[model samples]
Target: MPPSPSTRSQAAAPPRRDRGDACPGALRLHQAADGHLARIRLPAGDLTVRQATALADAADLLGDGHLSLTSRGNAELRGLAEDCGARLATLLRDAGLLPSERHERIRNILASPLAGLDRHTPSDVRRWARELDALLCASESATALSGRFLFVLDDGRGDVAALGGDVSLLAESAGDGAGPAGSALLRVGDDPAALRIAGPDAPRAALTAAEAFLTAAAASGSGAWRVRELPDGHGLTARDVAGALRSAGIEAAYVAEPPAPATRTSPPYADSAAPGIVEGPDGDRALSVLAPLGRLTVAQWRLLTAIADADGSGALRLTPWRGIVLPGLPAATAPDRLAELSAAGLITDPASPWHRLGACTGRPGCAKSRTDVRADATAAVATGTTVPAEAPTGSPPSGVPVSPVGVPVSPAGVPVYWSGCERRCGHPHGTWVDVLATAEGYRVALVDPDTAPTAAPAPARTAAPPAP
Candidate 1:
């Protein structure tokens, strides 16, 4: 759980950094404890099969023979040679993955992964994601945005609405005005208020909201790197952003204190631990596949692309959930293709113990990690000590053996995140079960929805110690 609005305002803040964020990009690699690391941002996580193949090639040739899917729908390559940046960049550019070097770091966009594919969603927010990305890249003011700045386009689904976006456009339901086609609600940061705009104006309004943040950040002169980083009294709001939109010649209507939808839900097929096949907007069916531990070996990558090209659309959409969606599949061929995926060791069953589990780069990859969390998590799963068959997605499974220190162990089934340490990098937003590593063992905690996002008492289980 994260801090509430009031709690955030009153909590102590970390010291301001003297330098800009050093987040890695395709061109600018970061020297991690493991090796050189590069992050490739994929707007709305769209990738052609050919592009994915190229990435696979690059991973084998320049990286550690694997790809890591990030929480923001980006792809990461780790354990690269010091001189691999040039070759990596060339391969990515040839594949159309690197569209703009200057704006690459700023193209942080998260769209509803199932927007057009699911019938519950009214619009294909991915289109708006493209428009917004192009606009942001074209605007000079956007260059001032930090690499951490994020834009979200949730297609009326709650899947990504709570993702802590700096600027967000949530699709409106029919009858919410604008028109029968509905409109979009623009919200800046965590403000309860929002701005209503026609669907057509959504992209521009989102950009304007970002620009407004830049303006306020400059006015405050605190060098705020994010919306929440501004001085307490100078924080931004929906009204200020709406005014900014008006100044930019976009009509904006302020919806002061909008009500949360009574029954907001995640995208359809999101819960299944098995092969998830959904109908696309074009009347074609698509297969949603999960990559265990958010990773794919180069061989797995090539296999996925091959499947997409042969049996489904020639495209792939990488989701923030660490899943890959191969849309545009012919309905008749779905079962066969899905079998191929499952045979290749990819997760295809919703009830699978492997589904919805995550681990950080522990052991040799990260110096800060107390243990090899990945290996420990794997052992926990292999020994039937983790994720059971009956738990719902995102909930903690119970009934594992207690730690040697006499702590009670929860059963494993629900979505659980394993972090090398307490930072909990790459953990999903909202409620989740957490497994944090400690020198003594692993402490499992359920994030209490009632409490202000703190680790509540659960059980402690000893992860198998690293082999000598």
Candidate 2:
């Protein structure tokens, strides 16, 4: 018998979705302004040497000669030919990148990129992610999940647990060499509370919770694509999820406001690990690098794949921060390999201007953008004009706090998002500077800076960012 769910109603229902999610997938290409865009889901951002080469080849032969990295650790190919869908699908399928066509779009998973590689991490959430992915593809019921549905696997290091996951499995501390057999917390949506269960059972528990969401969303008839979209007074709670898990014979201990990792990061996909070498506790080493502006050419992509194949492990770990980690590297040859990566235009230094900056595909790629935000942002960074992170297209918010002259950034690299318009599509959460592209130039504002602001707001300026 199935247990009843304890629904928690919100004060306000989320905006209703009348249409199906059009989020692009590998087979289902999206027609962008540049051309067809295909988003390839890499579960936990795990990529093999062969798979990486396939992508690079696809980008060069079919689409533009570039690969774009997403905040979910996935890769995107833009400027693709309108009729290249069949060839693209076949390439990915042969590489085993597309396992189940039916379940391809629903395989949105994010995990700690440094899982099993860093000393601070006690468990390898990557194993859990692989398990969950398999469960998703096998379950016919999971096919009903929206393409936008996301699952986050966070190791005890607290790297990727809070990037707005629909179903988040946070690995609890299991001491040294606990592996993946430790206990974990299963958090649904953004609820501060969680339900604890065995680590080995974490994957199953995640699937169960997601299934519960489907049931709730169906009952609500809200056409919600994500758990957070459930209407007010019709939401699922920790109690509801626990009831579902227990029905499956999985034990779930409830924790009111589960304790978060002490070293947690805010949203907008900040890179917790700097670009360079990461040493595991066992004396193993990995070479880390970042893509400038979250876009990579096939040349750069192949270079990374070659470096990984030669010096590091044959696998590439794509971080949620839009970075890559080449793990299991030979210690003696890592420095030379890293030098090669740096020379090839990859961001290898933490202090590099490209480290904390991100921008959407504005200008020619996106028809909605007012201007080329990326070019302006690059210019801003070059001139030391303090750049912020991503923003979307829409009207600017009134009564916003205005930023003072100059884009001041923290030493730890607070990200600045640049958008062609006001949608603020992928902007970083928490406090950040808002640099909106106005017809005159860029309108700079201090969004959610401090408790509030005083005095009159600064006027928008038309001057181009001065050179450094």
Candidate 3:
């Protein structure tokens, strides 16, 4: 059996949430400086060619013609007219993107982008994601989950599992000598221990754990939107999750020792899958490419959609790395299509400076922004002078991207995020370069996200190391 939540203790307590989360959904639009923004949740990032076309048409007909791919493998439409909400909903409904209006925002689910498509990992996690999504839509009690609440499904590749989800399901290989073949580990919050259950029962176990979180959150009276925010004394453990799973009629075993850590050797939260071609089964291939800064023009979106519709499996998998996976493409034409994508400004090379680069919507889109951070970040990358070739590799203890030696890491090796202000919205989870726009100029420093999974409010600006 797994240890109970009482067995563990935390040093820090997250602040109380006084109000409900205002995260925008397909039906509920968030009013931004540019205009109203709509976030369309795509479970497992799976979308057919027809659905992809619908999104492109919606972008062209309604809001800005650009679709923003989030770090969680979701998409957003900005600069939308508030009155167009009804029309947008109609378009989405017709495209079958909006399955349940009430459960749309809560449908935030991240899975292995290349699961079952390539030979690296043939786990059927996409099926699990779809199953869990349907279960959430049917459960009225699950409507209470916050939009930020995450469900990470990793197909033993350790890609999405390292994302630190509120409820995580890591796929275990068949006959791996761990437990029964085709089983998975269900993790809650930051606790290392997880619940092991049959593969088919993993989705149900995940839902049960989520429902359990809702119950614990209500009892805390803290209005916490996620498990990470359940306060120091309100933590949830694998034992609690196992009991909940049993109540739901799903068999589960506590895994005090989960099969090796689910983290990729390739820098945490960085380019998960390499860019360019990914070899698939039966001599076929898949094209994997990254979007420069996570923004895709309508033309670029259409290009990818066309490839998926004609050359590939008529499907596209939007990865959490702000990239796209075109599966089952012919080994012959896929390379040419990749070249077209590269010419269109997408990052096809893993060594490209734009691999891990990210920026928030600044200037006109956000009223709180002091400058146009997107443009500045772009300009910095264009120059290729963001980092010194001979600069020191080790970073200071306070904050700075550095090399792995002596706990320090290379500054260039760290991802860079351009923030308009201190809020630093949509920043990457791992250590990164903090390029904050100040009154004088850009304040470039190193920043590391809080290791805890809690959703704490942004801290006040404080003194930091000198800019590099």
Residue 267 in model 3: lDDT: 54
RMSD of 2: 7.5
Q: Can you tell me which runs of candidate 1 are displaced by over 4 Å?
A: 1-11, 175-180, 261-275, 281-283, 386-414, 456-468
Q: Estimate the Cα RMSD of every predicted model relative to the unseen true structure.
A: 5.6, 7.5, 5.6
Candidate with best lDDT: 3
TM-score of each: 0.88, 0.86, 0.88
Cα lDDT of candidate 3 equals: 0.77
- Order candidates by lDDT, high to low: 3, 2, 1
For each candidate, the alpha-carbon lDDT, in order, equals 0.74, 0.76, 0.77
Evaluate model 2: give its lDDT.
0.76
- Indicate the TM-score of model 1: 0.88
Residue 390, candidate 2: Cα error in Å is: 26
**Candidate 3 collision pairs:** 402-409, 402-410, 403-408, 403-409, 403-410
Q: What would the per-residue lDDT of candidate 1 be over residues 109-145, giving only the tens digit for each residue?
A: 9888877676667545888999998998799889888
